[model samples]
Target: MRAVVYDAPGAFSVREVPVPEPGPGEVRLAVEMAGMCGTDVHIDAGGFFSRYPLTPGHEIVGRVDALGDGVTSLARGEPVVADNTVLCGHCAPCRRGEPLFCANFYSLGVNGPGGFADCVVVRAEKCFAAGDLDLGTAVMAEPTACVVHGLDVLDLRPGADVLVFGAGPTGLVLAQLLAHGGAARVTVAAPTARKLDLARSYGTDVTVEIDRSDPARALPVLRAAAPDGYDVVVDATGAASVVEICLGLVRDGGTFFVYGMADEQLSVPLHPYEVFRRELTIKGSFAQTHCFERSLALLRSGRVRTDGLVTHEFALGDYGLALEATRSDRSCVKAAVVP
Candidate 1:
């Protein structure tokens, strides 16, 4: 087997490594495709505390090559995707129904070996049949699951006006979910015209081009798109600077959902009294949890499409180039490593 291994922070190498076999209750998957995300970039740059000497890809899809003892639900050569985050079921948070914050939480590609290799092994229960879903699109299951979790946090009313920031892959997926979940109108604001154009194709009713040099210039346009203010305002840019802007767009008594993975040390200046006065709901949505199945079902039903979203790909050996492209290439909606 061959794998992309991170020896340490700011270091990596692709080399021939021994193929791993599944332990009991696990299955080995021949890596088909693994989607690259901002998290991978973070992991590469030492921005995350992921255990090193690792194979860093979480958005993965592969064909089952072998199943371990007691694995009866799956068979060899079945296409599948798995939940990478491993939780200790008896943790205090898990018992509290908050396993996302479990006391002992770890994940593949982060805390353990992952995709980004010719083959990877995972727990059998974590694997889901990718039934007829294209491998490239199946890689979106993790992200879509995150978006579904965000939607769960929203608990929104049907037919409400919505405003979304950013138009990247996740932004577009969020838009589609909002539309399908019954948002009367969904508007997407992004700096890139091409992405906005693609957002339109994803059913966003309006797109606003924000000038990076002067983002405030788009405020009037966004306001005009929702003259009465939006029932829900979402920030998917993952930039701290955009938080206040999205907060301002939320209507009184409306929800402002922070779905972006902003800088950890970043802080926003928000007035407590304002929130108290407006009775506003400000929420933060984190990683995917218990939403993978529905995410796959959405792909199966054709409610979410990735034809225009997966714009770039690289081979396993070109991992560095893939990261560079993800950072510099605005045109690449979703970058994947096709093994």
Candidate 2:
């Protein structure tokens, strides 16, 4: 099997490795497609804590080539998408029905061998059938599940106004989810004109060009575009300062959802008094949960547009090229690696 291995920070290479077999309560997948995400780049850059010589891909879709002991719900040859979350079912958070907060939680791409190869072995419970969707579309289920989690926390009412920061894959998906959730208007802010155009295609009613160098200057422009102030503000940029700016842009009683991962420490002015006075709700959503099934349903319904989101694709051996393109190409919306 050919896999991309992360040797160290800023280093990755395609190498031949033995194909894995399913273990107890696990399933072995003939990996069909995997999406290149920001997290993959972070892992490759050692921005996150990860073991070296790792295979870092979690946005995966494949067929059930084999099943481990006790696996019965899924059949061999079934198309599936794997859930990254690996939770300790008896942990405090898990007992509370918050598996995402499990004390002993780990993820596929981060904690174990991931799906960027010819074969991937995952826990049986984490693999969900993709029905009749193609491999590429099925690979997107993971990210869309994250969007579902974001929407779950957002709790936006019909006609609520939304402002999405960053027009990347996650942000675009979030915009479409907000639109489908009955948001009256969704405005996407990004530095690149191409991404903004992509966001518009995903039903973003307004688009603003943000100055990456002078992010603060975009606040006034965003305020003008959302005159009444946004009812729901989502920061998917993963930049701490950008998240802070999003918090400031929301209306007095609006909700602010931080869906991005800020790997570094961020210092920002706090307004505890304003939070109390306005009764605002600020929340963070990490990873997907039961939302994976919801994401599949959304894809099946064809309510959200994913066609334009897949702007680039590469062969499994071209993982380096794919990651580089995702990081540097302003026009690339979402890149997939097909094995």
Query: Clash number for every model?
Result: 0, 0
Q: Against the hidden reference, what TM-scores do the models get?
A: 0.96, 0.94
Task: Give me the runs in candidate 2 sitting further than 4 Å from their true place.
Answer: none
**Model 1 Cα displacement at 227 (Å)?**
3.3
- Can you write out model 2's per-residue Cα lDDT over 1-339, one digit (the tens) per residue? 898887777787889998898889999998888898888877876876577778888898988999999999889998889997788889998999988888887777776788888889988888888868876577779999999988888788999998888888888888999999999989888898988888887678999998877677898888887776799888888886687787678898998888877775556677999889887888888887778889998988876667777788899988888898888888788889988
Position 123, candidate 1: lDDT = 91
Report the lDDT tens digits of candidate 1 across residue range 62-136.
999998999999999999998888888998999999998877778788778988999999899889899588777
Query: Lowest-lDDT window of 10 residues in candidate 1?
Result: 41-50
lDDT of 1: 0.86
Q: Best-fitting candidate, measured by lDDT?
A: 1
Show model 1 residue runs off by greater than 4 Å.
none
lDDT of each: 0.86, 0.84
When summed lDDT is taken over every stretch of 10 residues in candidate 2, the lowest stretch is 261-270
